[model samples]
Target chain A: MSRVRLSFTPAPVHVRTARLVGVAVARRAGVAEELLDEVRLAIGEACARAVALHRQYGLTELVLVEMSDGPTYTVRVIDRAPIEAGLGLAALPPDELADEALTDEALTVGVGFALLAGFVEDLQVRPVDEGVGTEVRMAWPVGR
Target chain B: MDLSLTTRAIGEHTVLEVGGEVDVYTAPRLRERLVELIDGGARRIIVDLGRVDFLDSTGLGVLVGALKRLRPVNGSFGLICDKEPLLKIFRITALDQVFPIYATLEAAISADSSGSGSGE
Candidate 1:
């Protein structure tokens, strides 16, 4: 199995760079040509969300991305922002709560996940096991 | 890499041409430009995204915010995006039904001339 990992400062400017690197890695991993756009977009949204969370929480840690090529090409984006006890367990439906009442930053973050759901077919959002924050895991089929 | 925004007046409408990627990093610039136009008394606006290579949800949020800003004054807002990849993003988000999207700049401007901003 081949794996690639990227870590970058949590910043909006770095989100685009992460997307580019993720797509290049995906292409090298045999992700289909037609699906590259989706891969690129999903990576951007994931990285952007991580950046927003880090900024909102005033955390300066690096955002983490891990990509592995196997039966499926998997990408996992991790943010170091603190999460409420049960917030991560609920799969971040903050979309519904986003409608009731939310700060502008929260709404912006919420919309990113909504877009991720639309772009990634196989997706999972969960709390980190060892530390604070959320992990957005997405998988796409690959051809060897 | 960088976003390029330029505006030109065409008849009673203002066409803002956008080029390059529109993601979280670049979307703020887009939002700022839209605010400037609205504040500068631009009522009917069409964003030409024909040159845009990439657009993310943050960019869509900026466009949606612009529409909201223009609605109170009965201003018209439309987009010109002929590229299939960008159009697919709109379709995936169901925003294709929300925004006035045209295939060409001429079509958007002509639609404005007909007293309707409904795009193609």
Candidate 2:
């Protein structure tokens, strides 16, 4: 598997920083329009959640990573936060999800992961360092 | 995939018919449409999302921003959310209460309700 990696401290609400870096890295490997935006958004959304968790749960810095597996570009957001970090976003605060109309129970757990699954071609979330940090990985098909 | 946006005028209201997924990538385009309508001097805007296949936070943000933008100018804004999943997401987030929602665009257009504007 061919892969490339980059790391960042995850600045506060700095989506541009993440997208710029991710796209730059992915572009070198031939990522296109809709897929590019998909990756960009999924990366930012996952990282933003990680950032919130770090602030809410206590972590040093967030890590934005990307990998190329020949046919696809996969990005993994690494952060030290509780597993619920992904679950909480299922029912985002009204202010954050101001245009959505879902219920807390309907949201359930792992909803963010579900959204990530739907947006990204392939999605995976697993514990890093035995659950000390979470790694949210998403892959998009980018043919040669 | 390219998103499709259509506009229809009923009485004094303008309904923007949105189709396709409303996620991060498409949200920006929708925001552009909202601004275009406002710039074109269309005050009464009803974002008809009946055809919207998917709605995410990024998409929702554009609407919230639009709501804020329409308010300061004392413009009317409402939404038509027929999809149950979409409705559930909005309800969970309490956004349904924040934005005037109607079963159909005609119902929202009939309300003639204008929101207070303050853009972010």
Candidate 3:
């Protein structure tokens, strides 16, 4: 049985909330502060990337952050973005950015993802829809 | 994250006493304040970060940006980061090569005047 899902906008203000809840989860799971920082940075960077991508598309209904109790912890940002996971960004340079995942001309821009991928431990991209919709799934190890 | 910055002028040197966390959120306020100070003819600056509890990459970016802005004018900038964590960041990022790191703001000002720390 997973925990309650907490959904909120991925704005800068909401990033703080996600961090706060993340701290609580880290405390309960006995994650170290250093690891907690990595989690916060990765999640914040992910949410920031999501928000910037969907800026011209008005906004998503809301970003869903689902937390559960298992061997590992996960944070997911659900947005109806027209992102394709088949761009093969797994080997792209982390110093720069590979916006090939974004088909939209305007959306395929920025160094936000470069920073995000470089910092996050387990970075994954999945196409959760028919040729669109991206769910950036990241996992951080527990037990410090 | 409240930032309280105080300026003290000791002869030809300008010292900035920065307090609170310098991150992506609070760095904008500092950037604006620095721009104002530089515009008002305060050239040589020593950013006293002894009171600052936290600083991030964005904050580092602002500091680097300030240094870039001041360098062409022959104005110099230094940081007072005696704390371990802050000092570690400077060393890790190799920013210590770009900007002088001093034990105290007073030392930086003194060294600047004596020409010992003139971009050494």
Candidate 4:
């Protein structure tokens, strides 16, 4: 299995770089061309969510991204924010949550996850076993 | 790519031309510009994304925030996005139904100020 690991400070600017790197790795892993956009969007959303949480909590730790290609291409974004932030996102209904998110600042972070879920068919949001944060795991099938 | 935003008056509509990528890092600038336009009494606003190469949920949130901001004043807000990749993002997020999207800037500018247009 081939693996790529990226770590960056939880800043908005670095999120773009993470997306670019994630897409490059996905392409090299044989992810389909049409699915590249989805991969890019998913990575952006995941990293953005991590950045938002880190900023909200005033934490300066680096966000972790791991990409692995085996039977399927998998990308994982790990954020060191409170577990509630990530767990709460999966429970919210994207459509109804999105309508109210415009007016509500607290609901804004969840909107990103909603978009991530929409873009990635295979998605998992859960807490890290050894940390106090959440992990956003997404996978797409490879053509080769 | 860096995000570029410029606004110009087209008839009664103020068109905000957006180019480059709109992500978490740059969305705040777009949001601030939208707020400035609304604060400056731009009632009919159309964001032209034909030149935009990338857009994320943060960008979508900025647009949605602009729409909500204009609603209290009965302002009209629309978008011009023709690219399939960008359109797919809107479709996936279900934002296509929320925003009046036009395939061209002309369609958006000429559409009924009432905010109805042929969207792709």
User: lDDT of each prediction vs. the true structure?
Assistant: 0.82, 0.66, 0.63, 0.84
For A4-113, candidate 1 gives per-residue lDDT tens digits of 99999988898888899999989998999999999999999888888877887888999999999998899999988876621432223422332324444544555566
lDDT of 1 by residue, B19-101 (tens): 99998999999999999999999999999998998998788778877877787788899999989999887776666766789
Off by over 4 Å in 2: A1-127, A130-144, B113-120
lDDT of 1 at A3: 90
True contacts kept of each: 0.40, 0.15, 0.00, 0.44
Q: What is the lDDT of residue B33 in candidate 2?
A: 92
Per-residue C-alpha lDDT of model 4 across residues A1-144, encoded as one tens digit per residue:
999999999889999999999999999999999999889988998998889889989999899999999999999999999998667774244455335434544435556766787888899999998969999999999999
What's the lDDT for residue B51 in model 3? 91
- Superposed model 3: Cα runs more than 4 Å off: A1-6, A48-69, A77-120, A123-138, B88-96, B114-120
Positional deviation of residue B55's Cα in model 3 after best superposition, in angstroms: 2.9
The most accurate candidate by TM-score is 4
The TM-score, computed over Cα atoms with residue i paired to residue i, of candidate 4 is 0.92
For B1-120, candidate 3 gives per-residue lDDT tens digits of 467899988788888889976644576788888888888998888899989865655566567666666867888778888987667555544556667889977788888888766543
How many clashes would you count in candidate 3?
0
- Tens digit of lDDT per residue, candidate 2, span A1-144? 667676666554354466667777777777776466556656656765666567666566656565666667778777777765544434345454432353322332234444465567677777775656778877777656
Per-candidate interface DockQ score? 0.39, 0.14, 0.10, 0.51
User: How well does candidate 3 match the true structure in TM-score terms?
Assistant: 0.68
RMSD of every candidate to native, in Å, equals 3.3, 9.1, 6.2, 2.6
* Interface Cα RMSD in Å, per prediction: 4.1, 8.2, 8.3, 2.6
Q: Pick the candidate with the highest lDDT.
A: 4
